[model samples]
Target: MIQDKFKRWIAGAAAVSCFMGAISAGAAASSNKLPFNDIAGSFAKDAIVRLYNKEILSGTTESTFSPKKSVTRAEFVIILDRVLGIEPVHSAINPFKDVSEKAWYYDAVTAAVQVGLADGTGAHTFEPAKAVTRQEAAVLLVRALNQTGINGSTSAYVDEEEIASWADSAVGAVRTLGLMSGDENDQFRPSDGMSRQEMAAVIDRVLQNVKWAAALNKQSNATRIQMGWQYGQTTAQFEQSVFQAKVTTLSPRWFFFDPNGVVADNADQSLVTWASKNKRQIWAMVGNRSNQEVTHQNLSNVTYRGKVVSQLTSYVQKYGLKGLNIDFENLAPADRASMTAFITELSTQLHKIGAVVSVCVSPDLGSDWTDGFDYQALGAVADYIVMMAYDEHWSTSPKAGSVSSMPYVNNAVTTLLKVVSAKKVILALPYYNRDWTIAKDGSVIASELTLVEQDSLVRKRALRPTWDAAVQQYTVSYQLNTLKHQIWVEDGRSLAAKYKTVMDHNLAGLAYWYMGGASPDIYTSLSNAERFYGLSFD
Candidate 1:
């Protein structure tokens, strides 16, 4: 009975594939009516046509598509290899006895196994010609998405009992992510072979869920900048840092805008000299001191805005500076247009002098605080847009929590990527944590703790922090002198998670909140992540 049903499904899919191939071939030449003919009414028509257009998948022939054909294990692996651009391991000795190095699918099979996406059927044997099962496809698809270990519920499916123990989580994950689904009977036929149309549908869904399409299109080619912000640090202090070697840019808090629209010049020549000697680009930070009135007054006036732009361009040329990091904050939302114009002028003048401009923006949480930033406009004008992704729990907050939680930062990045290109986005991480003291009267007093200070407090008080998976940080709570203290620690573990986010999304690069707050192990974690992701500081 199952075999008959599968055969009927395959016949329908084959017709659809054939129709899609004919349409796509015609589409390449000129516009035609109903590009897809027979499969126009098929549910998989859109997905098949989309993949066919991109040439990610093809029909069996120019006129006929064998969509009813069951995709072989090796064939599906090749498809995934193309989408992921998986590098093949060039080895003389093939791991699978059946997969020959001379075969067309050898590279795909080897690359799949190398990335832990697939394995042999038996010891040294990969049944490459065998049809891959639906459940097996789910596992491979989940791995290809780099989303393994995601817990999902498979109880909704009628055939949950048939799901193998090993593939249960993967099946659940793909289902929950809407990358795959059961048949009309709501049964996930675990052992059934996947048809070509089904595979195309799954692949199309995967592309929609991730950044693969964008990466392939070459929308962003900005060199990843590993930047570190420095404030109130001496030249010796900056030189003694361990992360300096891996840093590509240094943004020191040198310039500020006062109330009268006057530019305060605190440019450090010695720091610039040190940065030049170390072959690092110096993008000095120009801040507005978080004064809304001053920001509105300066940016709203054309003369003042030009003066500011002229001064910055002159400074960039005079000091041989690479660029400027605009750190304007607490601006009125009404100044959104003016803010964009100000940056547009600044970026234009700076670029003419062979200099770059990066604007700092707070995360858009649909709040007035972030209303001043027009992300898309800023992204277009500036060389880069830096996300100051921290301070979830402010210094004077009524509640005590992490300075920057994992979900908060992830949401921030995801939100920013919607407007700005990933190639021009830089995620700035915090090297400091906040310690909150809850008094008896319910008042919360928080103090900022640098990485070194946090470490000392942990050891001095003999406190052990357990991992908080929810926030992706280590947390510990203790009582000291009638006050309850809670700390969310920022160490290698937490920082590594952030690094993975940056790499996974293929962001421009990462930056630290301040150079003076980082420890030796932090740099090690960053170095390991860069190596793992094949990223370079250069």
Candidate 2:
């Protein structure tokens, strides 16, 4: 649902709204502008008024924005850099034979070069005085966002459609941010000239988006600016955060931003502080765990889902954290392609702000797996893979076995390695167990319970655990006041054994289930396991 709305936002709805009818042959409405305006002669006065009201694009003079005059390349960079907060990595200024140290456009041009906004010809000259063309301006604006787009081609091209096809991503990116728009006829005049009015209008739209994005990024950078981050994050990021630190072996559900199962306010601020102090890497949960679960749907679901995604991203960035973790699990069989599409779109959004996407998965045997765990497609974009290797056994099973046995762990690791790089797999371990009440009916619904709770129930009912070596599980099928109860518990020994399986398989790192259990040394034991094998999550 979130992905569908995001797709719609980028597809054409936004562009159509912004790009209105052409005022005349050469004077099309600048959707980038507010009611104030940007075009000169006629549009300049109103555009200046709107700019003044919004307090964004300013003028060279006290009263005039000079919309008719051709905007210089230097002025363009400054507008993007200062008001829009378009960051430019500073590099040594040494280009353009005509451009001197005393030139007006020198600093802006230099900054632009440092950020890959523009490149000079082999002549080693940056014509700062040269006017920026419409196509060239599009390339510059898109590059500023660091969007490789969907096609993964360079910004420059001779043909327009090929450019948009490659730029379907950049166009979508800018549009999502409400930065730029096309014509009512669905035409993006890439090669046209950027007039003073057009540049001002574009700058205004971009600045508006940049302010919101800047706040989101500020939170992300607080954690690790060196690694990078982004806004409009992902669904997996939402899942990981919502369910953060509350993960368990029998997790069929997860929460976000709520520490200890409560929704948080200003999650970005709270999480950033927590992450910086604890030296933790934060991950976002992406995709749709509930998008297709409903019987009937309306447009409201999409909007609500998009709200969740946007809010989640803002929350993550506000806190100094790691990257994102996608776990849009339990998908229907038919929505596999849609799931893939979500990841592709989602990764594009997260990567722009310098965040890494780590995907979670169940073992994919090429059959019977749900749509959310598309190993091949997910492997292509995510920074890593988290193989959730638990729950091979349930209370309802006719037989008993280790929920995550050596064979179960090994098989999952091996098959996933076929689809993704070994370095990216974070093998998740189960730290709990299952309990069952048996009768003449053969089996019943699995009682998903914690190990400690299971032990308490056993002590209360005078039930003793019987070790079953065949499957490395403990089964107690004893009569409790004329009724029989069976339980399986994963103790320290079983956990250690699973850790050994992780080592034997040489997985990336061992992740534990249910950190909130507050087991005396559960996390410590897992940490020791990693250290024992000379494997560091760091």
Candidate 3:
């Protein structure tokens, strides 16, 4: 009976050994198939895979990456050191009381301290096992990049007061550099422990931004066109304006197409001469006057379309014009194909004469106004596609809100970039705001206000404007005589925020809707952004 029991125990032992070997083999095979088993649906999966392919990151095990695990202070330092290619420094004296000469991370810690990438916690103690907080990681990242005296506004964050004083500048710098962002509630959780996945994502952003900076440096000599549309302003008025010195291209309302496909000649020779003397290219505007039926009638007929193209090309040759701005709006969705064909022919004819063609398109908001534009097809033929990213709350809207809020414009650009090339797109900004009045019966009426007018009204009425972080604009509201009035102010601060989108995307340049409505502060904001991005007016 004792011999029988020993045999049964041996058989059980063999079965257990085989099961362990199968697990090991399966793990090896899975590792060969993918970067990690646990990171299949992770938000940082791409970042982890990229870093792993570069041999800059490794998993905790053969087949599983602990993406959600908290990253220790010492581990982050080692990763940063590897990315920067900092050689480990050996020292006889250790700076931290917790680190020893025999420890594996001792040299890495010493190198990081020597390079000013990190510091001890307190009392000469380095908590190597402690998880790195978000604030601490931000400080270290700024130091690693060697950026000094960099500062950005932290007012966008709701929990700005929670950020430590020592890390204020560092956190702001990272936020501006696009290396980090706040949570959904716009709170920067400064004291929260950063997970391994967050570390990989931040590192990946750093690498990408570095590459983008290098590319910008190489393209410093390439001129980016800064254009502005002019209306209700003559040549003398334009010459006396501040925008004359800030823009590289001037688009004037020169030609208009009537219902009979007749091209109206509003072209001013004096303005053309002035633009040439001032070293600005004249991209004459050819508008449809928002007549949907006229546009359809003209574009749908082959002979009429060819006649329109011939007239435009003739005007280009007649005025010695450098370019043309096709401003067509308010069309039926069925005219999508015809609109593309018209632009294609116009662009082909203009290209032969060595003149550029830029087509203005409204943002694709899934409405009939935007559905008529085939962004991909238009981008293929036109030299540039100017996005009219405004009118979120139009004149006839039933609601009272901001016309072109921050989120609205950002989403518009993000969606447009998917179908068009960034190099071929120009963002058009509004120089005006809207004042809405809601009556006792709940009817809303909106009136337009230029930047200057909006400012004067705010001061005259003694109304205080509050900054709306979510919309990235200041708003004023008051009740007078049984009517509620609301105004969304567009000033230097809001314009600067919009300009950030241009720099972040490496877009072609900016275009103001109309130069007459712009104020001095608007030009100042643009100049500051230009200097910050290492971009000239052109």
lDDT to native, each model = 0.75, 0.49, 0.76
Candidate 2 on 1-538: residue-level lDDT in tens?
2223223222322222121111221222243443323334453455445544444444443333456666656656655444323332221224355555455445445444433345553345655556765555665666655444423223333343744443456655555545555666555565555677777667655535644345423321111011112222343452343244322211112233222212234234444444445454556344443445531121124443344445545544554334566665456666566556555654666676666666677876555454445787888877677787887875457764456665777788888888777666777766566766666666554677655565556556654444444544445556655656566555543455566665665555555554433243333333323332332111
Better of 1 and 3 by TM-score: 3
The 10-residue segment of model 3 with minimum total lDDT is 14-23
- Write candidate 1's Cα lDDT for 1-538 as tens digits: 2223223323333343332233245644332343333445556777877766565665665533455678888878867765655433332224466876666566557556543467778646788888989999999977766567567888988999999998899999888778888889889998899887788788888767545455433322346788888865786787556234477888888888875557889887887788788788999999988989888988998888888888888889989999999998798899999999999999999889899999998889888988998999999888899998899988988888988898999999999898899999999999888889999988899998898788778767766565576997778788989789999888765776787788889898888888878666567555434433442211
- Which candidate do you rate higher for lDDT, 2 or 3? 3
lDDT of 3 at 413: 89
Residue runs of model 1 more than 4 Å from their true location after superposition: 1-223, 242-245, 533-538
Which whole-number lDDT from 0 to 100 does residue 283 have in model 3? 94
Once model 1 is optimally superposed onto the true structure by TM-score, how far is the C-alpha of residue 29 displaced, in angstroms? 71
Q: Candidate 2 — which residues are off by over 4 angstroms?
A: 1-268, 286-315, 365-372, 394-402, 458-470, 531-538
* Model 3 global lDDT (CA atoms, 0 to 1): 0.76
Which ten residues in a row are the worst by lDDT in model 1? 1-10
Count of residue pairs whose backbone atoms collide, per candidate: 0, 36, 1
Counting only residues 3 or more apart in sequence or on different chains, how many pairs clash (N, Cα, C under 3 Å) in candidate 1? 0
lDDT of 3 by residue, 1-538 (tens): 2223223323332233221011134563574456678887789988988876555566666566788988889888877766655445443324355887566677667666543467789735889889999989999987776555677877899999999999899999889878887999999999998898999999888766756335323333436678888866777776556243378888888898887667888989988888888788999999988999898988888888888999999999999999999998887888899989999999999999999999998888888888888999999999999988888898999998888888988998898899899999899988888999998888899999877688777767766555576997768887878789998777655676787788789889888887867666467455534433443212
Candidate that would win on lDDT: 3
Q: What is the TM-score of each candidate against the true structure?
A: 0.60, 0.45, 0.62
